[model samples]
Target: SLSLRPANSGKVCSKGAFNSCAECIVSGPNCAWCKKLNFTKTGEQEAVRCDTQENLKTRGCSETEIISPKNIQQATQKKPLTRFGSFVDKTVLPFTNTNKEKLKWPCQDQNVQCQPPFGYKHVLSLTSEHQKFNDMVSKQFISGNLDSPEGGLDAMMQVSACEGRIGWGNSTRLLVLATDDGFHMAGDGKLAAILDPNDEKCHLDRENLYTKSNLLDYPSVGQLAMMLDKSNIQPIFAVTENVKSELQKMIPKSAVGVLSGNSDNVVKLIKDAYSSLSSSVIVTHDTLPDTLSVAYKSNCPGGDKPGEEGICDKVGIGQEVTFYVQVTAKECIKPVSFNVGPRGFTEKMRVTVTTRCECECDDPPMKDNPHCNGKGQVKCGTCRYDCEEGYLGQRCKCSAGQRDEEQLRRECRKDNGTECEGRGDCVCGVCQCHETEGGKTYYGTHCECDDEHCHKYKSLLCGGNGRCRCGKCECNPEYEGNACHCKKSNEQCKTGQTVCNGRGTCQCDQCQCSRGYKEPMCLTCPGCTVPCQKFGNCIECLAFAEGPFQKNCSQACPTTKVKVVDRLTLSTEAKKCEVKDSKNCWMDFTMEELQGFDNYSVEVLREQRCPEPPNIVAIVAGSVAGVALIGLLILLIIKALIYIKDAKEWKNFQNEKKKSKWTNADNPLFKEATTTVANPTFSGE
Candidate 1:
C-alpha cells in the first residue's frame, strides 16, 4: 500500500492502451502489452495489444510474446556513506530566562546560538573552533523572559526544510535538540492568536532572528518528520524522561535520551546518540496501505534473523549487507511504487509492483449453441444450461428418472464398489473428481488415485529420488521401497562367514539385527563365545615367538598374517585377546574375521608385559628391619603397662590411707599427751 490508490487507477488498460511494452508498463502497473504482431482480430481495436496480463495470456499470447512488467528495485546511487564530515550546529532557544548561571554551562561548548531581541534567532552557523563557539555562547547572547510552551516544532521545521542554509553535508547528519520541557504543536498556536500554519521556509532576517516567529503556527509532528526525512537529517532528542515516550511515538527513527535536570550531560548524550545512530542501519519504506504487508530478511552483521520491519544492528563501517524484501498483498490492489532505504541516507531503492486481476478472453453469452441440445447458452467455449426439471448432463439430455440415476451411479463406482472412490460426485453418468484446498485434484476414471496422494519419504514425494506415478512411487535403480526411502545395495550385510553373521536379516543395505546380536552388520553376538580365545595360543606363538606352539608356529597359525605394532587398536570387525605365554608374559593382539576365507589379519603389541626378577637383598633387609621394629613396639607396650599398674596401685594405697584417717593423728590415744606437750609449748610462744 505504497499509495492511496494505484498509480493510473482511473485509466483502463484496454481504453487507451499503448502499442509498445515500455509505454504500456508506464501507463499502468497492471497493463501488459503483447509482442505478437498479428495478435489483434481484423475488426478489433489495435489497443487490444494492452490489457491485464491474464487477458493477453488467455488470448493465445505466448509467454514469450506477453510483456508484463514485474516489480523492480533499482539502486541509483551506491556511493558509500561518508564516515566523517561536517555537520550544522544550529540552536534555537524555546523561551528566554534571566537565570544565566543555569544556561551558561550547557551552551558554552556548543556553536551557533539563536539569540534575542527575538524569542528565537539563528546565528554564527557551524564552526569547529571552541574559543569562537564559547565566546558566542558566553558573551554575545543575552537572556529575556518569555512564555511557557516553547516553539520547538517551528524551529525544527525551519532547520530541516532550510538545509542549504544550515550547511548539511552528505554524511551522518544529526540534529540534537536538548529540551527539559514539552514543546508546542500544530493546534497550540491558536492560543497566541496566530493561526497561520508553518510554511517550512527559512525566515532568518539580517540579524539571523526568526522574523515570522509570531506569524506562523507550530508545525505538526508529521510535518516535522517529513521535512527531516527529505533533508536526510537524524534528530536526537535529549529530552527529560517525562516527555521522551510521547516524542518517540511522534517521530519515527528519532533517538531519545534522558536529559539531566541541570543539562550537565548534554555533550555526553549527543556523543552517545551519534555513536548509536551511526553504527546501525535501519531500513524503512514509505507508508503502505493496510492490504499490503512487507517483511525483511537480511544477512546482517550478527546473523540472518528476519525483521518484520527492516533492521540490521551492530553494523560496521563499509560492511556490505543484503536485504530480501517480501511484499505480500492480501487483496488485489492496483500497482503502486515506494522508496526504501536506510534512515538518514539520501540514496534509496525505488520499487514498483504490479497486480493482475482479470483476463480479457471473457466473451459475452451466445444463445442456443447446437452442442447444448437447444437448452443452454455457450460462453467461453463452455455450456451454461437452463434446463427444465429432471434434465441433466452437458447437453441437458439425461433425465433424472430412477433408472438413469442408477446407471449413472453405477458408472462412477470403482473396482472396490465405492462410488467415485468417495472423492468425487457422479453427474449424468460421469465422475467429476474433487479438488483439494491445496489445488491437488483426483483424476482417475473412478476418482481412486492422484499423484499427490502417493506415500512420501523424508517429507518429499518419492523421497526426491524418484517420481510418483498415479499414487505409486517408481524409484530409481539405486533405491527401492514404497516411498523410495531405502537404498538397494546389500554390501553392508556381508560379514565373516555369512550374511548378517547368520543372526539377522538385511534390508535396504542395513542390518536388522535379531535379539542378542549387535548392530552394524550384526558381526557380534553378545551371548555367543568369540574364536579369539581358541586362537590365542596360536597368535601368541606366531606374533611373540613364545607359547607351546612356538616351535610349530607356521603350522598352528597358518591362516593368520601377524604384524607387530607398538599399540593394538580394537576394531568393530576385529576381536581382541590378551593371552599368557608359558613364560607368564601377557600378549595383546587383534584378529579380524574375514569373509569367504579362513585367512585372518592379526596385529600384536610389540611390547609384552612380564614379571621382573625379585630382589633377595632388599627382601632380607626389609624382613630383619620389620622384626626389630616389632620387638621394640612390644617392649614399649610392656613398659607402658607396668607404669600404668604402678600408678594405679599408688593411687589405691593413698585412697585407703585417707579412708583409715591415720595421717597427723598418729598414736592418738597413747602418744597424744607427749606430742601435745611439745606442740603446746611451740604454739604458745
Candidate 2:
C-alpha cells in the first residue's frame, strides 16, 4: 500500500523508480525498517521490515461542514459575466443576501484573478470527518460508472479521492491545498547542473543519494499534468517550507504552489489559492493591448460592429498572432475552421469557438456548441438521440455528456418538464423513448412502457410487439400479450405437466389432477390394483383382504412395479389338503411333492394297521418317542381308573365297616355261633 506495488514486486525491482526504494515489501512492513520512510537499514538483511502503520485516531474529530457552492453565490445563479458585467453584478449581489457579511466575492474580475496555470483544487486535511465533502464531489462525478464499460469506475474513484474539502461549481474551478504529512526525497535528485551525466560525480554517486535517495520515486509533478488532462482535474500542491526544493520538483511549474511551515500557513495557502484560481479566464499567455486588439477594438472591444470590438484573432497556421484578438463579424456566417493558436486567423466564420479562438471566452462560441436557439429552447424540432444524449441517471435527467438539446430542456425547464420523463427522455415535447438492455422502450404519452414487439414477439426484438423488458416477456409491467402466453407449466405445483395430462384444469398454472390420481404428471393412479406378488415381497394387506381395486383376480391381474414372469394362483397343494398330514399339521400334496414321496411317504395309521407297526429301527425310534408319550397317557388313565376303583372299594369297605360295626358288638358270641352253625346259616340264606 505504501506505493501500491503488486505482490512479489520486490523481486522485479532491478531498475526504474522502484529499485533503490525498499521495493514496497508485501509483508513485515516497518516504515522505520523500510528505506522509503528514512527507516534504518541494518537489520533489513536478516528481518525484512515493511512500512508499519500506526493505528489511526479514527473517532471524535469535528466534521468539516459541507459548503454548498450555490449557497454563497445565490446572486450570481445564472452565468458568469465578463469583467464589465461582473462589476455590475457585484454591485447588486449583496441586496439579495440577508447575511451581507457572509457574502464574499468569488473574485473581482477575470483578468484580475491570479490563478495557477493548470492545477485545480488539491486537498490537504480532508480527513475521514470530511467524508461528506468527499462524498458530494464523488456523487456529482459518479455518472453511470456503475455500468460504465471501461475506465469510468477507476477514474471516478481516483479523482474523488483527491477532491477538495470544499467544492466549486461550473462558474470556475479553484485550487486549494494543505499538506499536514511531510514528504521525503526518495530517488535520484541529482540535477543535470549538480552532476551532469558527463561529470565524474554522476559516474561515482550513481548508486546513492543524488541517484538513490531522492524524491523521484514518488509520483512526479508531471503525472499531475497527465491526470489533469485526463480527468479534467486541477491541482494545488501544498508542502512544508523546509522541503521547498522537494515540493518544487513535485509540482508542475504552472500549477498553484504553497510553501507552508505550519498549519496556519497551510490555511492561508488554501485561501490564497482559492482566491487566485476563482475565475474561468486565466492569463495563460500575455502579449499586450496592441496585440490583443483587433478590428473590434477600433469600435467596441467587448461587443460592437465591423472594425467593432467583439472580434478576436488567434494563432493559426500561416497566420500567427499573440494575446487575445478582437474581430468584427456581427451576423451569422458559414463555418470556417483554422488550426487555432496565436497564428490562427479566419475572416469568414461567424462563430468564434475557443477550439480555434484564443479569446477570453470561457467556453467555445455559442454557435459552434449550439444546443438551443435561445436559452432553453431547441433551435428546431428534431429528436437527436434516445436518453443517452448529454445526461446521466436512469433517464438521463442530469448533465453527464456534452449538453445538447435534451440537456437544454432539463436545465431550462422549471416544472415537471425534464430531459427524459425524469425517468426517460424528451424530444420536441415527445419522449425520445427509453430503451433497456433487453431493448424495451417506453411508449405512449407518459412513457408507460411495453415490449418493442408489442403483441407479436416471436419475430420482433420483443417478438416485434412483445416489448421485452427487465428480463420478462411482458406487454408492460401489467398487460400481457403474445410475449406472455396464457398457457403455463404446472411444475411448480409438483404436477410435472403443462396441462395435467389433458385431464385436469390449470388454475394459476397449477394442475388439479382428477379423482383417483396422484402425481406431478397425473400419469399415475392410486386406484390401480396391486398384484398379490411373491416375487419380490409379500403384500400383506392385499393378500389377506379383497377389495374393489383387487376384484379382478385372474382376468385383471393385479399390477405392481415388479414384473411377474410366472402367474400367481391358489397354492397347488391346497387341492390335496384332505389327506392326513405327515406332520399332522396339514397335507396339501403338490404334484412335485407327490413325485418325490415314493419311499419316504408314509400313512402312519395304515402302517400301524399292518399288524407290524414298523421296522425295528423305525419302531425303536417311534417306540422310544411314541411309547414314552403313550405310556405317559396310559399311566395317566391307569391312575384315573385306579383312583376310581379305590373310591368304589372304599365305599364297599365303608359299607363293610358299618356291617362290621354291627358285628363287632356281637362278635364274641357271633364268632362262636357262626363256627358252629356254619351249615345251618347256608340253609337260611
Most lDDT-accurate candidate:
1
Off by over 4 Å in 1: 1-116, 122-143, 146-151, 163-173, 179-208, 217-233, 239-246, 258-264, 286-293, 301-307, 327-335, 343-346, 355-685
Tens digits of per-residue lDDT for model 1 on 110-228? 55563333335555565556576666655554332354456667777767766666656555577878766677788766766777988888886776566787788778988898888
- Cα lDDT for residue 512, model 1? 79
Worst 10 residues of 2 by lDDT: 82-91
- Measured against the true structure, the TM-scores of the candidates, in listed sequence, are 0.34, 0.21
Model 2 TM-score on a 0 to 1 scale: 0.21
Which digits, one per residue and each the tens of the lDDT, describe model 2 over residues 574-598? 1111232222222222111111011
Steric clashes per prediction = 4, 54
